[model samples]
Target chain A: MSIETDIKQKKFRSPYQRLALNLIYTSNWIQYQQVDGFREHDITSQQYNVLRILRGQYPSPIKVSDIAERMLDKNSNTSRLIDKLLAKKLVDRKSCPNDRRAVDVVITEAGLELLKKLDPVVDEWDNNMNAITHEEADLISSLLDKIRESKNNN
Target chain B: MSIETDIKQKKFRSPYQRLALNLIYTSNWIQYQQVDGFREHDITSQQYNVLRILRGQYPSPIKVSDIAERMLDKNSNTSRLIDKLLAKKLVDRKSCPNDRRAVDVVITEAGLELLKKLDPVVDEWDNNMNAITHEEADLISSLLDKIRESKNNN
Candidate 1:
């Protein structure tokens, strides 16, 4: 659906305004799919993301800051999110040998198993999102990067 | 910057995955700017959005459900968001004369003044996002809408 129909708004101040709204709205729409997929696993989408990041470095423990740096949502508190994983026993945390000030996080076997189950589901979601072709996806990705070109930190 | 550098990921399963990740990351980037702007005004972005929707219907009253329908984030609690606006005296709330069970919300002059103050700041942010040309913005918007085409609802 068009953003105008989605938001029930007839006009935008400029193309920039429409693009801005579309970005946020589209993100929310995609996020809902992720959130729903993880609901059955008793984890928030952020938690699922954290688990996947940890699984990516399964054999080696990762520093909390390093995890935060790689997160899609950079604002999440790694320590707090790790704490949730710890409570669920899906991840193990330990003092870093290299830096005592830092914590080393490793995904537990349970986390790996959970992700193993979720992998196919995630693949299916991505397949559904293939409504647009690879060329279109590449074009969109390039344009999005261009959209953030003016920002210093992005 | 490319999504790879932004998230420090070496590879994606497919172009679709890259586009999905890029959509979310860029939204977070844009939302942070909105959050910061509304922060100085002592309202969250969602609250700012609600106030703007109300102001757009200045002379008339709208229902809580109506406001939710127009919100960028569909999960926002309309009554709760309206309560925050009411606390600041930016809006007025009362029982709807047409439907005694429904509440009517109207933006006060204060809300209009607040939006006036915010208008220029929003414009500047949109201007900052003009890293792409108007044609690029239009293309991105259309592509984003196409990305959601496979879904039954967006």
Candidate 2:
């Protein structure tokens, strides 16, 4: 199905316009799909992202700034997001022992268990992309990397 | 220049994984840029999207469902978004003359004025694509189109 039919829009001004719309559209589409997967466990995609990040730092505490820096959406209010996860006991936060200005965050055992369950679901979620072959996926990946390359100089 | 440095990530399992991350990361980057542009005018990207949809239906009111159907992010709450636009006096909403169950929405003069003001900003936004040549833009666009084409059968 063309994007025209997908959104019921007639046409785009140019392919760049089309690409811009499509990147946002497809990314949002995949995000919603991921959200649905997380819904079974009553978590939003952002929460899941936080959980994964915390898991990466399991056994070692990480600072809020570090998590925010590593997040897919860098500007996300991770302080608030961590607060939410803390409310659910999926993550534990405390003032850093050596650096009081920073807060330490770590995933809990329950959180790890939850992610263990979610791992298979995430795999299946990526399976959604099986429609595109690995070759196409690689090509698209390289192109996107190139697209962001210019931002490096600035 | 690589996504590795851009996000400061250590590794990806495969190009497919990288593509997935890049799509989401780049899309959000573009959206945040637009958000800054829209914020200067006191409107959000979602609000701008709604006003554009209403303009597409000028002289004939459109329904909340119609707006949802045409939105880039279908999961967004159209009713709530429209309510915000209504509060701002950017749009008018009333019961459809033909169907009381349906609400009709149309952009007000103020809304069109806002859009007119936003037009050049949007064009400048598009011009940012000049970072990628027309040829690269087309390639990116085609690649994204193909990516979504796989979504059709599902």
Candidate 3:
């Protein structure tokens, strides 16, 4: 449905404003869908994001700052997020051997197992976007990249 | 920067997966920037969203369900969100004149004043998107709309 119909708003002043609102609205919608999927496994989306990042590292320990830089929400407090994960025993933290200021994080066996269990769920959840076709998906991705392209020059 | 550089992840199995991840990631990035702006005003982004919806109703009393329907996050709990706004005195609620099951809500004077104070902040906040040009923004918006469009059978 058009955002206009979806929200029952009368009209947007301009395509620019519409685009801004649509991007924010659609993204939040997708996030909520993902969040609900994660809830079945007893995890928040951010926690799932961290687990994915750690899984990417696998046997190698990742630094907290590195994880922060890689997070979907860039400005998130990595230290605090890591603290939450640590409490859940989903990840392990240790002082970086080279830089004491950095903390090395590794996904635990339990964490990897959880992700393996979640692999099908992740597949099913993202597949919800099957409402969209591959061509449109590629187009959307390219457009999003273009939206952030200006940030590249800076 | 690309989500690749931002997240330090190397691979995406397909453009579809890449687009899904990019949309979610870029949207979150934009949201974080917005949250920082709202944070300065001591309101979370979600709270600010509620205030804007209420302001749209102005003198006309809106119901909790109305606000929820118009919200950007479709699944948000309108009653709970309103409870927070009510506690903050940013909104006034009374028993609906016609529907006992519904509560009438209006932006309080304080709420309108606060939003007025936030006007410049919102404009300044929008400038952060100067990272993206107006044309790019429009294209991005159109692409997202298409992404949500379904092929007849799906």
Candidate 4:
């Protein structure tokens, strides 16, 4: 559905405004779809993101700051997210060997296992994009990249 | 910057995965831009969204459930958001006359003024999209609509 119909708004101030709202609305729509699957595993989308990052660097721990930098949500409280993941035994933290003041985080075996279980859910999410062709996916990705170009220059 | 450069990751499982990540990352980028402006007014983005929804129905009140339905984030605690906005004197809430079981919410004069102040910030956001042509904006919006079509059907 178009954003206007989905939100029940009749109009937008401009095409840029419509694009802005559509991007946000669509992002939220995607998150909502993932939340149910993440909730089933007692984790959040942010936590799932964290685990995936750690998995990408498996066997090599990453610093909290690095994790924050890689996170999709720039505002997420990395320390707090780490604390929750720790409680869940899905991740482990250790003092950085070279940097005394820094802590390194790594996904535990359980974390990897959990992500393995979530593979199908994540796959289902990716499959949903099949509604748009590969060319369309590439176009959307580049357009999104272009949208951020102005910000990147600043 | 490409999504890989932004996140410092070199690989994605597929183009669809890359597009999904880019969509989410770009959305967060837009939100972070808005957060600074909204923060100055002491309102979270979700609260700002709620206020905008109420403004659309100014001079008339809306039910909490209706506000929830219109919200970008489906998981937002609408009643609690209204409570905070009420405490800040940005909105007024009362029991519904037609349906005693439902509560109605409306933007206060203060709320309208707050949104007025936020207009420039929102405009600046829209201006940022000028990096992309009007045609590009239209294409992106339609592509996003296509992306959501699969979910909407279910």
| Candidate number with greatest DockQ | 1
Every model's DockQ: 0.80, 0.55, 0.46, 0.73
lDDT of 1 by residue, B57-134 (tens): 879999998899999899988888888999999999999988999899999999999999999999888888777889
Candidate 2 chain B lDDT trough over 10 residues, lowest sum: B8-17
TM for candidate 1 is 0.95
Query: How does residue B109 of candidate 1 score in lDDT?
Result: 91
Worst 10 residues of 3 chain A by lDDT: A11-20
* Per-residue alpha-carbon lDDT of candidate 4 for residues A1-154, written as tens digits (9 for 90 to 100): 8788788777777888888888888888888888877887899999999999999999999999999999998889999999999999999999998999999999999999999999888988987888888888888888788779876676
- lDDT of model 1 at residue B144? 82
Question: How many residue pairs clash in each candidate at the backbone level?
Answer: 0, 0, 1, 0
The estimated TM-scores of all candidates read 0.95, 0.88, 0.82, 0.91
Name every residue pair that clashes in candidate 3: A70-B7
Candidate 4, residues B23-95: lDDT per residue as tens digits? 8898888888888777878999999999989999998999999999988887889989999999999999999
Per-residue lDDT tens digits for candidate 3, residues A1-154, read 6767666766665555566678788887677767878887888888888899888888999888888878888767888888888888989999998998888999998899999998877776556666666776776676666557764565
Better model by TM-score, 1 or 4? 1
Deviation of model 2 at B42, angstroms: 1.7
Judge candidate 3 against the unseen true structure and give its global Cα lDDT, from 0 to 1: 0.77
Candidate 2 structure lDDT: 0.81
- Candidate 4: regions farther than 4 A off: none
Native-to-model Cα distance after best TM-score fit, residue B49 in candidate 1, in Å: 0.5
lDDT of 4 at A48: 93
Q: After superposition, how far is residue B96 of candidate 3 from its true place, in Å?
A: 0.9
Residue B29's lDDT within candidate 3 is: 64
